[model samples]
Target: MNDHAPRRANRIALMIGHCAGMIDLVALPVWVGTLITRYGLAPQQAGLLATLFLGGAVCASLFWAPRFQRIAPERVAGWGFGIAGIAFAAMTQTSDYGAMAALHALAGLAAGSALSVTHGTIGSGEQPHRSFAMAGLALAVFGIFILGGTPVLVERAGGPALFKVFAAVMIVAALTSVAAFPRRQGATEQGQRSTAHIDSTVWYAAVGISCMGLVQAMMFSFVERIGADRGFGVAAVTGVLVALGIVNLAPAPLAALLERRWPARYVVLAGPVVQATLALIISHSSEFAPYAGATAAYAAVMIFTHTFAFGLIARLDPGGRALSATPAMLMIGAAIGPVLGGTLVQHAGYTSLGNATLAIATVAVCCFARAGRTRAVLSEA
Candidate 1:
């Protein structure tokens, strides 16, 4: 058995898979904006549309991840990426909200499958951390592309044209996955079957991840609206998102450094606290410079939290299925978050919405802290 072959194939799959994931996310805000502008969707309806995508992802992951464990993971991933690409292409032709929603849901389902299979492939390898780091790097680069380039693309190409471009990208990613991913013999041959029950530690990690997702969804969904309400223009909002993407790119290496120096638990706990403080500061200040600084801070904290929580779950679960399940749980919370945040914004405005997010962050920090302590004590015992 050539060990290097599987590992190399896994790395390639992770990079392509994460690129696909980012394309899905990058399309999200733009899709919501399209629904609002072209279809005259209310903010709540736009939020719900985002929620529907996430909800579909959650359901698909929960039902489909285990089945992939029984089938050929890499082939499943290839098919998923292809389906997602086709779904993106279909978006260019649809003006009907129901049709768009259904297609987006299908896209979400495919995204979930790709994510699960990619993680499963990476997790099967010996040096999972290195694989995860590579995956994180891909995510950061994709974020940079989406944040920095999407606005320009939208301006130059228009919405339909932008979808066409992304469709092309997705098709390329799908084709690459098919070429690069190795054939898995079977799920059982790859590893042990994952028991379906959620461990308490994994549950705590899931909560932390979900809270992180909630904060992120709120930021992505309303950051522009908040900036506009606070007297900044569209360019400023795009600038902040781009800055956030840059900050997200910086943290993968920083997370590697911190992981070398400190325990994963400490990094996980600190991230939410930092994010909460930044959110609180942003809630109080309406100034553009201060808000931008706060937004950068929020971005850094979110990157750290997301990476740490994901790493922790990967480490805690001996069975790699936890990788798939953790993200699924987080996506469920993400599905719920934007709708709730939009309601708060509708009734109480952006500041109050920020406050609500801060409260959630605080609770998340406490939960992570408790879980960390419990893990420490068990290790000592």
Candidate 2:
């Protein structure tokens, strides 16, 4: 019991940190809605503000990732979340758009810094695939919580209530992490040493994952709009979003189960193709049945595929620096997706978005294939 307790506590802290780091996905709707309704910002303005958060996160990830070996992952995580909590607390005091914008960026930077190290530490664990999947599962559960509860809380208490809730979450994660965050494993038994530099395969893998992120953000940002534009009605659209959230719970465990059965390389290769197909369906389908089904399954691809990718990258680079840069790779495309998708919709229409996804998906497949070829060499090393 004594030995088990600390391990259990470490997992919970790491899991919670993962969820908090990725809070932007579930919290984005509330953030944008609050900005538009409470602060009277235009949609474009709200989007740019959100982009500032993502931009800050990307910058932090890129800056911190290279130093993964030098810094204590737990210390970085604790300080990052602590700073983020302060930023969130500050947000509750302001209704000024400029002030809120700066706070969002600060929160994002701190959160991203914590997230990068958290992912790095996980990647250095005994079972990287299962560890990342567990983190993914926690994020899914957290998603349901935020979706079900946060909006109602905000409705009753106003937009500032949302920031208060965010602050509280960050503080809890910070305290827990500092108290119990686990140390990463030393270099692998197979002689995978901690190298300052990773090879091209890791870069290829990162590019492939980034392409998928681009597709997810580009299509997902407009899913409700697509449904509404096609006369799916409010009830139907809401049902899809609700179903989507619930369905998200399955992918992480499923990926863990399939870790041995499915080759990670094949999964990475297949993910973007599957993602592009679903995006096409979501973008072009006039009928509700097809659109709802595709929209619900859309995010699952990234979650499931990323679990495998994380494991594979950890094996290829035991130093953990590449995995630490996970946030930057994921968010680089995401940061640009909304603005670029909107431009495409404004100029070329929804089909153009589908076409774009196809092109991007092809690029992802090619990159993954190149990475796969080298995996035969590095994964064994």
Q: For every model shown, what is its TM-score relative to the native structure?
A: 0.89, 0.89
Lowest lDDT 10-residue stretch of candidate 1: 372-381
Go through the candidates in order and give each one's C-alpha lDDT.
0.68, 0.81
Please tell me which predicted candidate would have the highest TM-score against the true structure: 2
Error of 1 at 113 (Å): 1.4
- How close is each model in CA RMSD to the real structure? 2.9, 3.2
lDDT by residue for model 2 (108-219), tens: 8999999999987777666778988999999888877775676568768988888898899899889988998986444444224665457779999999988887787777
Give candidate 1's TM-score.
0.89
Residue-level error in angstroms, candidate 2, position 140? 1.0
| Candidate 1 per-residue lDDT over residues 150-197, each given as its tens digit | 767766766666567667766776787788775665434236536645
Error at 30, model 2, angstroms: 4.1
| Candidate achieving the largest lDDT | 2
